[model samples]
Target: MGRNIKRILIIGMSIISSLAVGIIRTEAAEATSSFGSASYEWMQGIESPIGVYVSSDTPIYYMEMIVTYDPEILQYSSGGELEEEGRIKVEIVGEESIEVSQMLYFVPLCSGTTDITIENVIVQYESGETAAVASTSAPITVPLEEGCALKSLLVNGKIIEGFQPDILSYTLDLAENIEKVEVTAVADSDTTTVEISDTSLVIGENRIWITTMNEEGKRAVYTLTVNRVQNLSGEGTTKEEKTRHQEVEVLREEKEEGGNDIQRIVFLILAGLFFILAVLLFLLIRISERKRRNRRRCRAKRIAYQKADLLKKVRENDRQKEVLNKTSEIEIDVQHVTMIFKREKDEATSIKELLIRTIKRQRSYELFKALDDVSFTVYKGEVVGIIGTNGSGKSTILKIISGVLVPTKGQVIVDKNKIQLLTLGTGFDFELTGRENVYLNGAIIGYTKEFIDEKYEEIVKFAELEGFMEEKVRNYSSGMVSRLGFAIATIRDTPEILILDEVLSVGDMFFQKKSSARIKEMMNGGSTVLIVSHSTSVIKSNCTKAVWIEKGRLRAFGTPEEVCEVYEKMNQE
Candidate 1:
């Protein structure tokens, strides 16, 4: 019985020993094959940690591993061999087990769960053995955070709120004089940065853009619009400024009252002189009456003798009256004319001197002789052209004839209220509409409202502004305004004498041709026209007589061909 029991115990002990050896071998194999493992841990709102560790059972001479994650969620900061595009390559060179850890910068672009994966993992052993392993980390949860957004927007130091979050546009209205504006924006979080486009406002309208950005590469944009309206009251003066002006007016009235005292005393002295003249006139009338009575008695006696002579005198007077009626018609007769302009000398060269002179009201004038004893004559039904170079007093003579400038030394005798002068774009109000300006300009030139109303459509048609008549004159181009002004001045009313100053050179070729034809038609209707032009061809073609002035003196006065020939020769010389 003892021998049998011993045998069974020995077999049991052998089996136990073998089982322990196999278990040890299996554990050793597992430790050698498992070269490394990877894991990652991330907390909310904090940088994540990624780690790779190798087992001590196997030593690696060189190894490469790749770690990848959602780039929008986490960005690799450091601790890798080569890192790009959310993937990091790690290399380990050692004779023992090693641990590799990488710091991943987190950007919470959204509130979601994400994973950091270890992919394409490769490990090479010192004994020329290779291993591949792939793994993924636990889900990392990101908390919801407010992204880039504007908390407040301020314009001109005034906060703007109560706006729809989705609507990023706003508008502001200001006075026209407000030429500048300042803008500021506050972001929802300190992690967001804000930028503004333009803050300088213009006269009419201005647009400003504000951009906000967060650390997660998210963006928000807002826009602002400003409209500036013109202030036309007080002629652009403010209410406070008008109050100050009233104070100034009161002081001026007080000063004028002091000067009126002297005027009143001078008026009394003039009244005494008029009284003496009245007494002298009464004495002269009594003497004339006594002389007339003596002559009346002698006239009765001679009446019978003068009857036959009176009949002969009446017949002769009748004949002379008929003769005188044929030669008395006259158009423009500018006789012995002289013009002088007095202007202040330019003595101030600097701003300080100019301001001082203005404050002191000091003035010194220099006289310039524009025309010296100039004389010209125009008969009825004639087209006279005045030709000259620049600053030659040609326009000055015309101005005198047209009653624009009075001659200092001579007389201009023309039919009263029978003249019209056309100057380019003169007396135009640019702020008014084209249609309104037509009537406004017509009133200024002595045209009755009924006459303008009758001719309004005619004038618009002539100016070719049918479609744009309601548009503002300020918006019209220079040529368009010139055309409108010329059309109104020329076609609105017909005058006996028409004066033109460089009006033929206005507008395009077609309009010039049309204007020339109209002038010719007026001349054919027995209306006298005087023109000042630089084009020799225009003068030669349209003028029956030409007057040339040079350096404030008449150089020639004759037919257009004769005077222009001389003028052209002078230019060549």
Candidate 2:
């Protein structure tokens, strides 16, 4: 029984040992380590002076290094020599303090890499005599990243030379047989970024190949450059003796897996909510679009019916007016036409003063009795024309008649069933597309949305901007905008009194002739029309009678020929 137990124990121990060795090999395979270098200094003594760099011409005996390490290792050792351009004496003050006590001369190097090292570092010994460790520091690179090119190595203060390259690529000459070759690039400007490939360089003269590529697949070749640095006399330091100390920081792997599952569940829930929201939004948008389309269809039908009714009424009134009267008659009755404009206090003392100043001081505003005791009446179907110089209130009169502006003092009375004030092209929001502005202007013209929808295609065709209908009115040429505006105004089939405001100025000869014919058709259909123009040709060609307005007063009101003759004579005077 004892022998059997021993065999079992031996077998179990061998198995355990084999498994432990296998696990150790696996862990080692997965382990990784990286190497880098830092710089430390040696003090001359506990109170001795150190050297530093300053912009002054004065010599500096004390220095400082931007070093890393907590309570840095400071000590003196015998097995070290600083690889500098000059010789420097190093002394140990405390048991762990190291420093340079004597000044050293330095030789300057021009081109090529220099070997800089600190030797004679005294460390702990296991079983050998005079055991020491070598601490290597990177050679100082000058001119930063863009200035100098480093392409060589140094070890222990000597150039251990005779190096050749396997591949020779160059912006400059290179040595051969480089090892632990690490090539790095640093940039001064933020415009470009630099990337380094190799970080290990061997100690020796070497020939290296360097390649640079831009974002555009453009390649540039730079010669592996080696710059020589001779001024290594910054400070000489003795190595500090360190006690053989091993510290195992108790790092407990918490294996925090519970919170990971919770985070995954939260992410899944959020993802599901987003998906549901996206689906809901899509459905809502689709429904809204459908409703908008239905409303547009209904509006179009209503507008069509209203346009037909307006055209019928206009025809019936035109017939009634033409047959009832043959002689021209005029009656003016304006209860009171008052216009008020707001003014800032700084502008003028009072409203009356502000008005006078506007007329004289600012020449842009012309004061006029836009309509003074203005009240008028004309026999049925009488054609009237209004003429005035720029600021003499011709447009103001039309705007009042069209109900776009209200008089501050009086009431306007018309014998006609309805008024059609043809404003030509005005009051258009250029930000909206031509098609969109059509509906807006239609509504302003007393046509329902339904009517605009019914004639939408016809309006676009008349404007001849079929392809550009959707383009913003701001983008339209002046001619295109005028045509579109004219098309929208005239397309409204309405009323007894048709008022025309210098609308014939736009369009070519063909369009003018076409518009004239349309006017004649409306007139013959018995519509009472009021025509306003500075053009004698339009007045004579379209109006049976005319009214000339000069300086906010009626200059002439008679047949077109008689009125225009008076206008010519008045202007000549």
**Which residue pairs does candidate 1 place in steric collision?**
none
Candidate 1 residue lDDT tens string, 1-573: 344544554555455445544433222211221212232333223333333544434655456667666664555554564467778776655323333222323433333345666667566654566665545454455533356567788887888655544455687888877777888788778888888986777778787777666797655556677888766462678788877877899999989997777656655554455455445444554455557756886897689558746755675576445424633565787755779999889788888998898899885789999997666668788899999999999888888887888899766777657888877666679899998898888888778989888989999998888899999999998889888988888874457898888888768899888887777777777888899998888899999988888888766666788778878988999
Off by over 4 Å in 1: 1-327, 347-355, 358-361
lDDT by residue (1-573, candidate 2, tens digit) is 334544554565455445544433222111111112232222111111112111112222222222111111122211123333232334322111122122111221222222233333332111122222233333321111232232332332333245232122332223333334445443223343333444344443333434333343222223354432222222222122111111111122223465556656665665555455456545554565667757888999799779756855775566445524522342222333555544343556678977887787652433445654333345566666776667666777677766778876555545434678877556689999888899888887777988899999988887778899889999988888878888888886645778887787767777666666666676676667777788887788777766666666544445677667767776789
lDDT values for all models: 0.69, 0.50
Lowest lDDT block of 10, candidate 1: 27-36
CA shift at 510, candidate 1, in angstroms?
Answer: 1.4
With candidate 1 superimposed using the best TM-score fit, by how many Å does residue 509's alpha carbon deviate from the native?
1.3
Give the number of the best model, judged by TM-score: 1
- Candidate 2 has what TM-score? 0.37
lDDT of 2 at 94: 16
Give all TM-scores, in the order shown: 0.42, 0.37
